[model samples]
Target chain A: MSWESFFQNLSNGISLGGLYALIAIGYSMVYGILRLINFAHGDIFMLGAYIAFYGMLIFSLPWWLSLIVSIILTAFIGILIDKGAYKPLRNAPRISALITAIGVSFFLENLGLVVFGGRPKGFYRPHIFDEIITIKGVRILSLTFYSLVITAIFLVLLFYIVYRTKTGLGMRAVSTDMETARLMGIDVDKIISITFAIGSGLAAVGGVLWAMKYPQINPLMGIFPGLKAFIAAVLGGIGSVGGALLGGFILGIAEIMLVAFMPQLSGYRDAFAFLILILILLVKPTGLLGVEVKEKA
Target chain B: MPFFKADHLVMRFGGLVAVNDFNLELQPGDLVGLIGPNGAGKTTVFNMITGVYRPTSGRIYFQDKDITGKRPDIITALGIARTFQNIRLFTDLSLIENVMVSYHVRLKSNIFEAVFKLPRYMRQENAMYEEAMELLHKVELDHLAEEKAGSLPYGEQRRLEIARALATHPKLLLLDEPAAGMNPNETLQLMDFIKQIRDEFDLTILLIEHDMKVVMGICERIWVLDYGKTIAVGTPSEIQNNPEVIKAYLGEEEYA
Candidate 1:
């Protein structure tokens, strides 16, 4: 009930939302172009965090370099996934690609479980991001500032890429009509691969920041955050990037505020998020920013 | 070297031979027409040449190089571009942006430059913007460059499609039913527009049309298909006089 506690919760909620937004952008971007749900995207997030973890721990690289290295590596991994699992199924029925996505997801999760071991370990907290400051009697975690700053930076870059650039034109065109894009001389596959690269790269940042917030390393750590972010994507009208960000912050604030206002419902936060999604679907069908894209008959 | 050639093309689906041994050749700067009734495999033939469908048996050559089985984008890069039977404008994009998508193939800036908005990216983007607007102007759509393409009137959308295709710097352009839904006034303007672009761009143009007036008026040479076979090829007057072509269009009673 205290204003101080409310502000603290709000801060934490926004930080969490920032991470969710990043991952949701990944989900939305891929879905925007391919209309594929990309169930394996969450696993890619897990892979990213793990990659960064080993980059720092095994290679003894600094956190910054490890972050960059993890992002680049994960991007290629994304392209590899598209080539390996999704590309061949492109001409197949939509359901086939969807099923393969789930399959790829399960494979990665189990791969993580076996290779990384089942036990949870403490996530390495880079010292600089461990600092906490108080503002007007409300405590602020440094990770909050870091996550928000990083998310803001990436979102700006994304806006430029999606709206202001040539490749972005190709992205929108491919999403509109893949065949027409090809006829127009846009390399559909290359655009697709770049989409995965950008989406997966953003997920890498989300994973790193997410680990910093949760401070737990486990094979299945991505499950909850990934699921939550995917919900955010759907809630934000699955194909719109700005919608994802809005959906993320909305979902984040709603969850934190729910638990804050009623401790009794703390365990129900996840359920509440899904509850919001169901309501949006029933009421609007299209997410807040989703335009009804008519399929040509 | 033929500017464009599709030789002995055949496309079969299960028991149906959609296009049987269909062939076409275009000399540089020629405007050709393909006309057939519905299901006559005109569009199917277009698909084979543009890489939308693999011909069961055929050879497609462009600029003397065999381009059969190449992907659509590669074929496009070899200076071929096309519009869809149903307009395929990037509906969400602004009219100018639609044209810019066609320029994607020629853009030299890489992803890093794009994301960072480096001088190189800014330079190319500026150039692309100017060029895209010019293309829109050709279609008389420059004033509405900021509007979503899907929001354009039916006739304007068709014009935008042609403008977008031309932005690819194509040596050969294929338009599938470009005047499909146009009013007679729009169709007349389109005929003139098509002729203008062929001369202005020095392009080889191929079009599939059911509109006999437009086809007969503009096409220097017309090829007709009946039941997936080329039934006639000649000047418009010759095609109109050909007994077989008349029989193909109307039934046996009309020939009597």
Candidate 2:
């Protein structure tokens, strides 16, 4: 491949990685606290896209306002999912919650199919994001730039909430040991709801961005991205946010580069994430950044 | 009014009655101990009081309020805190962060303000930082404030757990096997630390310890449990001499 196309592919890879990282964060955060893999997370991402689509095309709301509204609504849905489904199962065995997650995922997907229909709709990209820009010899879409920028901003905000804030401290405490956290006056339930809210909100952001970049929407569109993001989370270490980001970038870049250099291997692109997942599990079950959290006696 | 009370607290798991008819009363500034062998339901009673497990029957009261079956955090918010039998520190967090997590109960700022670092949030955060540092200093872990909580020695980790508990500004404090793994010297220092904290924080303490020396040295009063029943309650000296307590601990004289 030419140097110019290589840089171009790299930009695409980074932008795609940013999306994967944003979505993977949702998985990582929820798993960190609840130790349940939120299978419905990708469906929530799908919901964000549809909501944004309707908000823009049907309601004709401004792009930024629609995006914000979709994000808030999607985040609310996250809290509702926890309250309605997960909270009741808090004391239930881990396997029960995991199964419930899968059930919720199926429920949401079918719900989407029923509500939005199975037809793929064109996503409305803002004019500003539709423009093509060339820096030196590499051509980059403005949408990709915006996706990278927006992802960065959200990641920063998220890190601040998880690391720098009092609520974040409570979150860390709860994630480490829920019983001990409660003993410290940290409300385990409240922290959990907040986690779902933040994780789902990030998923919504990723969803909206995914729809825009692909310029297409369907009830099942989130499946691939969601699965890929899950693979990314596992690659990063299932419960580590920094690991998710690192995993996301590596996965995205590798997927793009694989197809870029070996055109015949394009058919295996989707399989590539699973391949990485298997390799990580076989070689380093904890992922690259995961640390073994010893059980408290 | 009693500062803390557990009235007829019964905890059952399936067919097992883990803590049956467990009762406790503590006056303000009281330092008490709950002693029993493994699986004797001593920790079960602590678990009930701390809201880890709601009692199958009966109630828990603290500061004259009925806190029975309340959520653990709610119980903590009403001025009760505890340490685990085994260390339960937020291992990934720094020592200061572990202490700071407790202060979150009293945080005034909302999520938005916290995320944005608004002036009000910053002020509260700064104050919280100062207070958490003071707490670490009080526990003598201030010099190692930046270290991961799990990195500390076992004794220091136990102290950090107590410090974390203290940051909740609790009126009633529960220590579950606080000296489980301490040496003679460390256990001696722990006894002093326990008494010092009770006095310093004006705390009413309820402790569960396997170490007879620590219990006898520190507790003003003691309760002995066997087979989920409270067999005796009295001063440490009285408990030490009680034949029932002796039978519970060392078995019958026939066995001896």
Candidate 3:
């Protein structure tokens, strides 16, 4: 009920929303082009955090350098997963592709548990960000400012790529009609591979930033964020980038404000998102920005 | 020698033969027509040629390279391109972007170059845009270049499909029912456009058409089919007078 608590909640919401938007962009981009949910995307984010953790621990690298290495490594893993798990089933039925994605998801999760112990580790925070800044009795961390800046930069770059570049044109083409895209000689498979790599890279950045802000790292950390990002994607209209960002911010603020105002519903935060998803499907199946495609017979 | 040849091409769906032992040879700069009544398998033949469906048995040669059973993308890269009987433009893409997609195979820049905006990538990208614009202009659709393809009028959508197909730089173009939904005036204009492009692009065109006027006016050679088998092949005038063609058109009542 205090104004100080309200301001603190608002800051937390924006930081969480920024991270969600980063992960959701990856989901939306992949779905836009391939119409595949890529269930392994969450595991990719986890892998990113783990990569950054190991890079810093083993090499004693600077934080920025560790972040870059983690992103690149995660992107490579993403492409490998696509080639190994998804490529062989491209010609198969849609259900088969869905199953393959689920299989990949579980494979990554289990693999992480084995490779990186199950115990949660504290992610190291640089000294500069450890210091808290208080503005009018509301406390904030430097990490929050970093999250906002990174999200803004990535979003602008993504928008430019999707709207102004040649490969972006190919992505739009393939998403709209795969058969026609191939007939146009667009190298559909290669474009798809690139899309996966980029999406994975974005997910990695999101994971690292998330772990840094929360100061906790574990194999299961990606699950909650991954699921929340999926919800964000659906809210924004799955295939639209702008929609995902808007959806993430909206969902983030809503969840925080709900808990702040109605303490009794704190336990139902997850259910709230699911209910909104179902309602949207029923009321407007395409979400806020999705275009309805006539199903091919 | 003909630029493209289909020899003894047969396609079947289960027990029903969709195209039975169809043969056609297309010389460079040739404009040919495949005409038949409903269920006559004209579109099926186009599908076979374009690799949408594999023929049950037969050979397809483009510039003397056997392309039978190859995937559609491979076939397209081998200098053969096609449009659907029902227009299949990438509806969500802008009109220019649709054409640029067809030019994708021609792009020589790698992902690194594209992402970094290297000089070579910029050159290739600019050239592609120019080529797409020219193709759009050729189809009189340059003015609508930025509109979503699905938002175009029906006639413009058909033309945009052709423009996209042309961007592939194919030696042979297959048009499946290009005049399917056009009115008489639109159909006549389409006929002229098809002929103009055939000469301009120096292409070999094999079209499936239901519009007799458009077919007779534009095609130098015509093949008539009935029940999935070719019944006649000749010039438009000869086909008009052929007894088998007349029988196929009017059915057994005229013969009786």
Supply candidate 2's per-residue lDDT for A277.
92
Worst 10 contiguous positions by lDDT, candidate 2 chain A = A288-297
Ranking by lDDT: 2, 1, 3
- lDDT tens readout by residue for model 1, B1-256: 6778889998999999999888888899899999878899999988888888989998999999999989999888889889889988888888988888866778888878887778987888888889989898888999999999989988898999999899989999999999999999999999999999999999999999988888889999999998899998998888888889887873432321
Please give the distance, in angstroms, between residue B248's alpha carbon in candidate 1 and its true position after superposition.
0.9
Per-prediction TM-score, chain B alone: 0.96, 0.96, 0.95
Model 1 residue runs over 4 Å out of place are A294-297, B250-256
Q: Can you tell me the DockQ of model 1?
A: 0.81
User: In angstroms, how far off is A28's CA in candidate 2?
Assistant: 1.1
DockQ each candidate and list the results: 0.81, 0.81, 0.62
- The Cα error of candidate 1 at residue A75, in Å, is 1.2
**What TM-score against the true fold does each predicted structure earn?**
0.97, 0.97, 0.93
Q: Please list the C-alpha lDDT of all candidates, in the order they appear.
A: 0.88, 0.89, 0.85
Interface RMSD of each: 1.1, 1.0, 1.6
lDDT of 1 by residue, A141-176 (tens): 887888899889989988888887778878988888
Error of 1 at B184 (Å): 1.6
